[model samples]
Structure formats: C-alpha cells, structure tokens
Target: MFRRAFWFTAGAAAGVWATTKVNRQLKKLTPESLAAQAADKAIEAGHRLKDFALDVKSGMSQREDELNDALGLHQDPDLPANVTALPGPRRLRAIEQDQNDPTTQFSYNRNEDH
Candidate 1:
C-alpha cells in the first residue's frame, strides 16, 4: 500500500511540473490577435444583454400602466360618504327606569359609609 501511494504521489508531482512548464511557454508565446478577438466577443455579448434587459423592463411597465388605468385607481368620484354612522355611539339608560326622571332615587352601597 505504501509503495502504491508513493508512486501515485510521484506521478502527480511530475504531471504538475510538466503542466507548469507548458503554461509558462504558452504565456510567452501568446499572440495579441487572439486577445483582441476575445475582448470583442465580450463587448458584443454585453450589448445584447443590455438590449434584452431594456425590452423586458419596458414591456412590464406598459402592462402595469394598462392595469392601473383599467382599475381606476387614480380617480376620485363625488364627495366622500359619511363613515360616522358605521359604528353607532352607545346611549346611557337605567336598567330599571329611565335616569332622566327626577323621581327615581339613585342606589347607594352601605360600604360608602366608611
């Protein structure tokens, strides 16, 4: 098992060394024309993406405006209706008799003598 692991590690190190050497050679041999071509492709893709985004936003906004108009959300009609009658105020009345009559005596608790 140890022998296998050692050979495997050695093989991996050799492969990495070979890859680094190849990368250095390729970096030194790079042609300016290929780099320019890649840059041009990137710019063209950017313009296409920008156009797509603008079209999507414009279509969405147009649909939103149409819906708002159909719903009449921006319009106001006539005077505002009275909302005071919605929840009627409570009236005070004696359970046994009407409190407005002066003849009715008000009840008093015996504890009030303290």
Candidate 2:
C-alpha cells in the first residue's frame, strides 16, 4: 500500500511538471508573443536602414571632396566650410501685415536719405 501511494504521488508530480513546461512553450508560440517579436525585428531593421543611409551620405561627401582635390578646384583651404558658391533662392515678394489692408503710401528723397 505504501509503495502504490508513493508511485501515484510521483506520477502526479511528473504530470504537473510536464503540463507547466508545455504551457510555457505554448505561451511563447501564441499570436500576441509572435507579433511582438515581429515588431521588434521590424524596428531593428528600420534603425539599420537609417544608419546605412547616413553612412552612404557621409561617403558621398568624402568622395566629393576627394574629386575636388584631384581637379585642383579647392582654392583656399582656410575658407569657411559653411560658405557656398551659389546664392539660395530669392523671395518673390515682401511680407505684408494683412492681406485685406490697403497699401501705405510713402515718399523718399535720395539726398535726405544719404
């Protein structure tokens, strides 16, 4: 009777352990868990793409400088890097205070202004 009781207890314990393990595995395979994993992978891929784009832009700038050096196009090494050879687009019209407001009249004298 003691031996049978011991065997039954051991069997019950084994069943519980097996059930817990299977539950954990099933949770990992659930739709919500899978979706979360896929989302994480997608975000990682987007970050990699952004980093690759920045690398490409930097490489292009470096190559542009090298080409300019080979052609002897860079005249002054001391010149400010922010300066550009061409001017940017000009504004077409001056800003007005209000669209419905009538235009103000003004008179100017060249001699008085000077």
| Candidate lDDT values, in order | 0.64, 0.68
- Over 4 Å off, model 2: 1-17, 75-114
lDDT of each residue in 56-84, candidate 1, tens digit only? 99999788768767876442332133211
In candidate 2, what are the lDDT values of residues 27-83, reduced to their tens digit?
Answer: 989999999999999999999999999999999989988987787776444334553
In candidate 1 the C-alpha lDDT for residue 79 amounts to 16
Model 2 residue 14 CA deviation in Å: 5.4
Q: Among these predicted structures, which one has the highest TM-score? A: 2
After TM-score superposition, the amount by which residue 111's alpha carbon in candidate 1 deviates from its true location, in angstroms, is: 54
For model 2 the local lDDT of residue 91 reads 12
Which window of 10 residues has the lowest lDDT sum in candidate 1?
Answer: 83-92
